[model samples]
Target: MSHVTDVPAASPEIARDHFLRRLSVETDCSDVAASLRGGEPDFVLLHVVGSPQAYERRHVPGARHLPHRDISAERMGEWPAGTLFVVYCAGPHCNGADRAAFKLAGLGLPVKIMIGGITGWQDEDLPFASGKEPGVLRP
Candidate 1:
């Protein structure tokens, strides 16, 4: 009998976790702003489920929209290959951001979830587009 060494591939969950930990190109709103001011951000903004309404009302000016549910190879063509992308949901309690990150990483794209989502951005007192609220942006 011959013995063969076998190693399992990393699961999606593990892959997502690993990617998040190793991310050095990620940015929150403040970082995003700095990058934008410096010319362009290092990453692209991705909106999770139900975030469209909020996004359309106001986003980071130049941010492009990539809805979570519509994520796929076909839809991904709109974005550059291996672009440093950041996914964001409504808030910390939401898992949409993480889910989006997982999907993006699975496609071999360098990605990360903006830890606090839009809520955190507001907390930073950063500039954002407005819609329903005086200083809030929503689609």
Candidate 2:
């Protein structure tokens, strides 16, 4: 049999559960772009890696710079506990997004990873923002 069929696929119910669970914690570049382009995004988008200058040079428009190393409960308290955070990093090669998500979750905050990160954003030709602020997109 072809490698594709080497292992049977999960049943539809099982597949739905698996995807639903994944969707709960992850988002894609396209979805994020659409949300940003549409207007005010409901979730906060954060860049979880790089220096301030690097972020200013180029980053998903409206994304706030917040390295994974800097995430802390006290630092995150500026927003209400329920504020959902969507984090991204340099690309699939980077784990900074994962680290940030862990910290945010540890603080009992809602969080999700913007899958594909900057690389994905670039792939989709989405606009980026700069400067320091609410980790949100500029109008």
Candidate 3:
């Protein structure tokens, strides 16, 4: 038998459990939107990267701008303990979100990746704000 066949396939139950675990750890655009609408206080949305021009073009309504390179525990000190930070980048094509998430998690902050990033948000026809004004993006 080929070397690949030597490994046993995961049982259906095991696969299902793995999938559920992964799903539980990741947040989707719709969930983020709902949380924003409900004014959920347990989590914060973070925009991982995007230039000023990019931000002006479009961005998640309430996402805070913090480049991945600048992410640090000190910079995020204002947040309370156990805050679930939902981080996103430009899109699947961009890995900034992954980098930011890794950094934040390493810093002992609770973090989850916003699957699909801003592209996914826009794909869902979610509202986005333009310009440099903070908290100006409205649905």
Candidate 4:
């Protein structure tokens, strides 16, 4: 495992080192979508809805709901065995995703946090579903 040093230095080595470290265990929203399309993922996608009403309005496709306040041992099994997990919340500045990521990682599961969260996904022009996700590619 590469060491992740949270330094502010702008040296080329530092930036390269950071990128290499992140490459070992880092993924983003686009990766998740591509995996879903290819049907070859080893992980499940989870979206922690900060607000029930917002969740009802729209969310990522195929996301399983695990409210922030409701994540616990009892619900940890909601995820699949040996599956990597990706967690996202309302958006940036939202602790829901961070908390969920920490909790899943603590449970000894490989997990990735969508740093920008759902808001960032939307900002990037990604598709979302309201009501039912249909579990299919959206136009």
Root-mean-square deviation per candidate = 9.7, 1.9, 3.5, 5.7
TM-score of structure candidate 4: 0.76
Q: What is the lDDT of residue 52 in candidate 1?
A: 58
The digit string of per-residue lDDT tens for model 2 on 1-139 reads 9999999999999999999999999999998888987798888888889998898888888788889999988889888769999999999999999999999998899999999999999898776766665444533
Q: In model 4, which regions exceed 4 Å deviation?
A: 1-14, 23-25, 132-134
State the C-alpha lDDT per candidate: 0.69, 0.88, 0.83, 0.72
Candidate 4 per-residue C-alpha lDDT over 9-119 given as tens digits, one digit per residue, 9 for 90 to 100: 579988899998775455677776777677655677777865656665787877777776787767877656777778888887788877887887787877777667787
Show model 3 residue runs off by greater than 4 Å: 1-9, 136-139
Each prediction's TM-score against the native?
Answer: 0.69, 0.92, 0.84, 0.76
lDDT of 1 by residue, 15-124 (tens): 99987766653557666656666664666766665755766686555555667777897888786777877777777888887788888878888887776777887788
Q: Judged by TM-score, which candidate is best?
A: 2
What's the lDDT of the predicted structure labeled candidate 3? 0.83
Candidate 2 clash pair list: 61-128, 61-129, 62-136, 62-137, 64-135
Better of 1 and 3 by lDDT: 3
Better of 1 and 2 by lDDT: 2
Comparison by lDDT, 1 against 4, better one: 4
State in Å the error of residue 34, model 3: 0.9
Best by lDDT: 2
In candidate 1, the residue pairs with backbone N, CA or C atoms under 3 Å apart (3 or more residues apart, or in different chains) clash, namely 53-138, 53-139, 54-138, 54-139, 57-138, 57-139, 130-136
Model 3 TM-score is 0.84
Cα lDDT, model 3, residue 71: 87
